[model samples]
Target: MTKFIVKDIVDKFGYDVLAGKDGINRAVKIYGINRPGLELAGFDFEKNNINRRVILLSNKEQLFVNTLSEKVKKERYEYILNENIPMIILTEKFTDKILLEIAEKHSCPVVRASNITTSRLYQLVLEFFDEHFAPATEEHASLINVFGKGILLRGKSGIGKSEMTLELIKKNHLFVGDDRIIIKQRNNRLYGQSHEMLKNLIEVRGLGILDLSKIYGLQVLLDETKIDLVIELIHLDDEQYKSIDRLGIEYKYIKILDTKVPIITVPVTYGRNVSELVETAVSKLKLDEAGISCLKILQERFEEYSK
Candidate 1:
């Protein structure tokens, strides 16, 4: 389970602290945001799951609270604050004295964002929560995005993974990460990124460490990408290579988190253009995805001829 603190939100979003400064250490468990508009309209607000969420009061909600009678306003505000929500956010400079007072009394953090509108604030907050709460793991591999398709290269150390990645970058493909790849799972899709310290950097045997962004320009570096294909490089003898499947009809998959990504095995041999071969493999994968599998088409024709 992932946990985000009120202070994390404040630091990330640059929200102003209006009240409950001491409660900034509170934990936010839910990834959803609540508007509290229905609650201010005399509706019986659901408090069961309110404590886990960040409640927001936009301009329209603040206006609705202002129009209510003093007794009703106090009652509603008291009911909401007593629920001990993780935090409350006010958008577009909205500030209500009573709401702030009640939040302070209950020790619930209240924050204000002056620049963004209500809808935009909601969108931003939800996006942040989605990323912060997603499941993540790390891998020892090189990740690159070729023609908008993410390709992961895995092999033993000193097996030319980084060298091949550099070649692909020279061919104008985007470099995601080298040596270490941080993968996060969201909505059953795995997204890969490099560690902050290693971003835009790759280590080659003779060249040592090279900053790709500086050498190949900014277009050569990619911040992150989905893991679409996993290619494992193997150093096999000529006979061993000949023994492997040649039809390319066998389906192989590698599981990352809960998603299964197609895997291709490439032999690393002397005089072999591994970089171009990997590029061709990616093209074939894309064509297969588009229902144009060459192997499948040939198999269909062979079956028809046999009949």
Candidate 2:
């Protein structure tokens, strides 16, 4: 992955360059917004990961800097800048003259984010870095939203994933992607979307390619969704289906970009309403969440009758 740098943040946020033009390209390793409360009180910079974060001297830090001895301020400033951190951001209401002098001397970029409070700026900058460093991948699947649950349909070619998607949309579910899905994992959760070219479009055997937005209206389309469950379709005969676990008491999770997503295998047979099965499966999941499982209830009833 390309390193996110100080200049990138400067250009992106339109912040003023108060000092340190030379080191504006310094790389950022983490998304932490460091206020340096500990370092201000004479804590050692060498002992912590200051270089990994973009130092922000907010209004509080700036006011606190005035009370510090000139020796303490100068020594701490030099120590922090020497780490070669990405940048130092000053919020709207704050600036430290001594810190800027040391920062300029060491070539550590000092940016001024105007018109935003320290708390708001911290939240904004954290989100920016978190999103920038998010892990992403591509998967071959048809993603849809059924009963407000994001469902990913996967199988071999000609296994009716697209056909099932069509039927699901007709039943008022939302379509996300067909064939190629761009899966991004952020903050330990996976979000899936279609490529711009493939958005709201699906190819059927007899219908070639169809724009779902045109046929079913734009209300039936979604650009992306959080992947809640994956339903894998398999062409299983009755004998093969009977051998597998009939009760879904335990769910198996498949790792997608460092996130484990629950996966369930469904047998697809000729003349079966695969889309209805998919919807019913999601409904069962909802019931399971509500502490009502038909299979578990059946087991209890059978045990009671035997007793």
Candidate 3:
């Protein structure tokens, strides 16, 4: 989990370290005072420990710092922090004395931002938090970005997921995470990205780590994807008898962060165009999003004709 502290924002935003220089690099924890709406959405508002959740403050809004006494500060800090909130974001250009005192007493890092508006600062903070504390999910597959949606493909080690991705590259899909996909939960949405080390490298059965750019050229490799869809490939079973959705009746869910992503199961049978079927599924998903469904539409038309 990546925690955000005021110091982290200052360093990233090029603000001068005012008071809590020591705490500047400390872990970020969520605080109760972040947003009222966030609390309603199931986030603990009062917890004060360094975790993935980051508490952002804006100095421009004019908080009542003068009315806050040392005793009051300590009491309020303890009161809200008991709820398990993370770091505190100070938007106001605060004095070094106040920052130092907060750091020493509460062990919470305070950050200062100059020249940037509160809204812009909030966006930067959110982005930082999202990247820092991405959730942990098992990575048995590779994810790529086709058009704009994130596509996750899974198969056995030797089932040619990477090879299929190579073919999709010819169809103009962008590259994303390969081998391992890192998912992060932000405000409840799941975002996926590729690992830094294994990115753009695929392992074949006989060959070791092969650079995708060298083999398939620069166009074949991608940096990251969001994981909008999950595709699972399995060996064909006759007697085993698998039940697939002929009417798209079944839906599969893959939990990335706090959200569940749509999944499609594709059986890898001989003499079938697996890659093309996956592509068709992708297109079909898009159409489904637009309030269109071939099966449903056909059924409706038939009912109307019968009427």
Candidate 4:
């Protein structure tokens, strides 16, 4: 339900507004961009529900339209204008005076970007829409990338989340964010990043704040990553530990911005190497992704032995 104005795109991309300045406030309801190729070739816009999409006129599409007869071109323009599209973008220095006139007549905004190619323009607009329309939330935790997998560490303050992340950093894992992690859901996946002011800064008890990138080198940090796992560290008494499941066969998931990320609960007990345990957990997740589940295999063997 997110809406953006044609003026927003014009301001953000610095596009030249060729005509339809009065329609700058036109609402763009959908994040999709259309080429208008099929529509130019007699496709029905109403049937396809393309009236809400922002139209882009690339070089090839423009050239193809130029080959059509004048009557067909006029009809195409009339059909498009009547549909009341959000806006039209001409990519890579290609411009049609006739199309601009039609847009002006119907008060449809037409913009031109001459610097980038059509594909690059498409990519930029896609990224803009993805970031603008994505569902996002924030978490008070630390995120790190280990072996190309993003792992989020969450727990109460003083539960050693930062300290454990420090250990992972020493083991050559990459740090993403500390204290506050911004998580956004795009295409059913969760991605995490640090706040602008807190990036690369980690706080340790009694040690003050430390710049992790400075100490461990720039290669030991990632600006953002797709969150693949969530680990929660809990300080449990002996009785509490005894009441928990020992088999570790249950699946736990934490919801972040409409995406469910697998979560593991680890007891923060003395003499336990939480960092190593997390590392091993990530490796096990990789194995699970590859369809090699150690827990399932052990359960199968146990079933056979019991029989």
Candidate 5:
């Protein structure tokens, strides 16, 4: 997303100024395929100058125009060189000599876009921006980051995943992914996504669909979150799998992109206050990392009592 002044475009492309000096120095942004910010492909009018019309040099947005006659192509090229178009974006490869001549003569910036399909290129570009612009740390699972960690609430969809997130939001925690988290791994970092179908909206079994942004006043919902933990809710019962309050075992790993992430499981039952339990689990994990294990502490205290 490098910013280019109109003069920069002209000076680089080798196009002759056929018209307005008003736009000559006006600023524009050029996205080249090889650049970090311009990794996407597509014909975008979204950010175009209100007064300037972008002239796409490629035929049908294709990188190469094989359908046109060589003579016609040359004529088009000459026409472009002589026109006062704001900027010219090149897709097809041209010899450096010709390109240099055009640049030297016209002073128009020569930018080469990737050869991918316009739609795909645009998608890639958008995705890149989205990932690059995401926040550094996310505190909640409802929002997903581009790293592909789907922190989902896996307890029957109604066990207050969204509600708990709303509470977490009140605690000033950033939201990342929600109800339907779409996880994808890019460069080994786990990113999470809110399914487009459920974006900014949460479904509470008996309560139906709720707009988190509206109810929470726009501070609650986030576009995505980087998932490092999975908080699973379980109904407490006389089941064999009930977790004990002991330092017993540690580090439950949830598999995503073949990577194992630490998992924290919390049990829920009537009148037990599940959300508070989850918050405690999160806090305990943090303490565990700092070498303060609650279970281990309890065990040591018990052994001292026995002594």
Candidate 6:
């Protein structure tokens, strides 16, 4: 399980830990952030729901808490201050001794948020957790930026994938990752990147590992990219080459996580310039995305003439 604990938040945001130091290691259950409202009124607060989330208390919650009767207020504080919550963040430096006392009594982590607006803090923390809790996987493929489109190249070993990558990089294209790509699915989209140790590194057959950043320049390297397309390279015989799709009407995809990325199957024959083919494939993808299809245009022209 992905363990995003209270200390993780403290480390990420540099928030001052005000109280409840003991509960720092409690993992944030992947539920999400919560702003206590009904719970603040000492009503309908579910332990299972609120206990797993990181609580954010801003100006509105504090003002609402001020209106509660002392009996209800004490009850509310004691009831919501359950054990093992990730942390309660007080935004805009809002602090209360009573709340801190309750939090300390139950050992719930409370952090004083930095000098950022509550909404911006919410956005920043939510984005962090959303990405941290996202589903991820690794692929035995190379990712490159071709014409601003992220294309993942996959095939058997020694099939000229690396050579094609090197060629593409030489044409001023950016190299995202080679040999292995770490992919994460966020908000129904797949993002591809290289492992930190393998960043800007590509291996070629008959040649040792090469750092493209040092060889070319750091500008040739990309930290990450949204996976826009996938290319499957295969060795094809004469009959297979003849069987290739002549029209650009056939649509294909490769599934990664829950997202389906558009895919192209290109046959790699001897002496064929795979780099140019990749560039052409991406160019065609760009045209297709813009609703400009050469085949569609030709079909319309032929139909008009026949009519």
Per-model TM against the reference: 0.79, 0.76, 0.73, 0.73, 0.52, 0.88
Mind sharing the TM-score for model 2?
0.76
Q: What is the lDDT of residue 237 in candidate 4?
A: 63
Q: Per-residue CA lDDT of candidate 3, range 1-307, in tens?
A: 4455556656676765444454556545543236323332335443444343455444422244445676655444445432233355555654425434655466555556667777777777677655665556657777777767778898777677876776677688876756877776666766666777777776665777777777768875666555678888877773322666767854678776668889887877668787787788888888888878888888999999999
How far does residue 12 in candidate 6 sit from its true spot (Å)? 2.8
TM-score of 5: 0.52
Task: Write the residue-wise lDDT of candidate 1 on 55-86 in tens digits.
Answer: 88877787787788878988888877754588
| lDDT comparing candidate 5 with the true structure | 0.53
Cα lDDT tens digits for candidate 2, 162-232 = 99999999899999999999888877999899977788889898889999888989999998799999998
lDDT of 4 by residue, 1-307 (tens): 3467889899999999998888999987787898888888877646546447898988788788879887888888877775458899998656668888888988899998877978889999988888777888889999999989999999889889999999999999999999999888888999999987899999999999999878888998899999999988888863445655666676578788777889888889888999999989898889988988787899899999999
> In model 6, which range of ten residues has the least summed lDDT?
42-51
lDDT against the true structure, per candidate, is: 0.85, 0.84, 0.64, 0.86, 0.53, 0.85
Q: Please report the TM-score between candidate 3 and the true structure.
A: 0.73
Candidate 6: give the clashing pairs. none
Query: Which candidate's TM-score is highest?
Result: 6
Candidate 1 regions exceeding 4 Å error are: 1-3, 7-17, 21-29, 35-51, 58-76, 79-84, 91-96, 112-121, 237-244, 300-307
Instruction: Report the error of model 3 at residue 219, Å.
Output: 4.9
Worst 10 residues of 5 by lDDT: 34-43
| Window of ten residues with lowest summed lDDT in model 3 | 31-40
Candidate with better lDDT, 1 vs 4: 4
Residue-by-residue lDDT tens digits, candidate 5, 155-254: 5445667676666666666555566666666556666767667677766567788776777666655675656677666566635245554453677787
Off by over 4 Å in 3: 1-8, 29-63, 66-110, 216-220, 238-241, 254-258, 300-307
Residue 116, candidate 4: alpha-carbon lDDT: 90
